[model samples]
Target: MARWEEIENEAPEFAARVRSLFEAGTNKTIATLRKDGSPRISAIEAQFEDGEITFGMMQDSLKLRDLRRDPRLAMHCPTLEPPKENPESGPGDAKLAGLAVEVPAPPDTPHVGAGFFRVDIREVALTYVGTPADHLVIESWHTETGYRRKTRA
Candidate 1:
């Protein structure tokens, strides 16, 4: 697992593209594990600060509870509909999977009494239509395997 900064250092262009996708929208989706080991999907807003990707939840929120119980999580950037006439023009979609490590809030933090966490990324991926719009393309980076790209019909 590595911090967001590590990804930037290792794969600058890929990291930039992924970060742009995340920043393009205000709300993102996160999946956490429930007590029964089921997946819980929730809306969230994350920030890139101090070389980390962090998010905060309201105090005592179920999502916070879920994170406390199980730190594993996956996050998806806001999805954009690809242009039917020119699918290659779309910005595409990005996703990341990682472990959420709890962090201390700063003294003047806005989240006063909330839970905060930083992602220790396991893998990151971006999916989109290929240039000719004839196939789907997936670009991914993993902690152990590094970066790779795949295309499918």
Candidate 2:
């Protein structure tokens, strides 16, 4: 229900951590629903700008068709192994679940007939291990609930 921008404005600190995870790597993973109602996972690059998350796909891409049909999607930020010497420095991981509202192509667009969509985030979360005690922390934001935190010692 909320766009990335709204979350940022409402919960700046939590949003920063989630956005950092997304910015930590260029390649992210997206999950889409296949025509047969099964799940398909694909590599994608997304842009978080102008208070929205957007991505484009080549013409006739399965993911594109899937989004067109189902719209629902889940995306995850790329993960890195914890540093050998400093576990505290681990950047953690982030995930977004949302609906992809396809953007209408502009007549003069350069990518020919590529597909585009703006993410309508339903849930956003970041998971990390806290310092010292090393408890697992999961911080999440939702359109209806705002923000919540959970820790497992």
Task: Give the best candidate by TM-score.
Answer: 1
Residue 138 of model 1: what lDDT? 94
The lowest-lDDT stretch of 10 consecutive residues in candidate 2 is 127-136
lDDT of 2 by residue, 1-153 (tens): 888999999889999988888888899999999999999999999989899999989998999999999999999998877786777678888999999998887578798769988999999988887785368888999888989999988
Give per-model TM-scores. Answer: 0.96, 0.93
lDDT of 2 at 14: 90
Tens-digit lDDT string for candidate 1 (27-144): 9999999999999999999989989999989988999999999999999999888888999999999999999999898678777679989999999999989988999999999999
Give the clashing residue pairs of candidate 2, or none. Answer: none
Q: Which ten residues in a row have the lowest lDDT in candidate 1?
A: 104-113
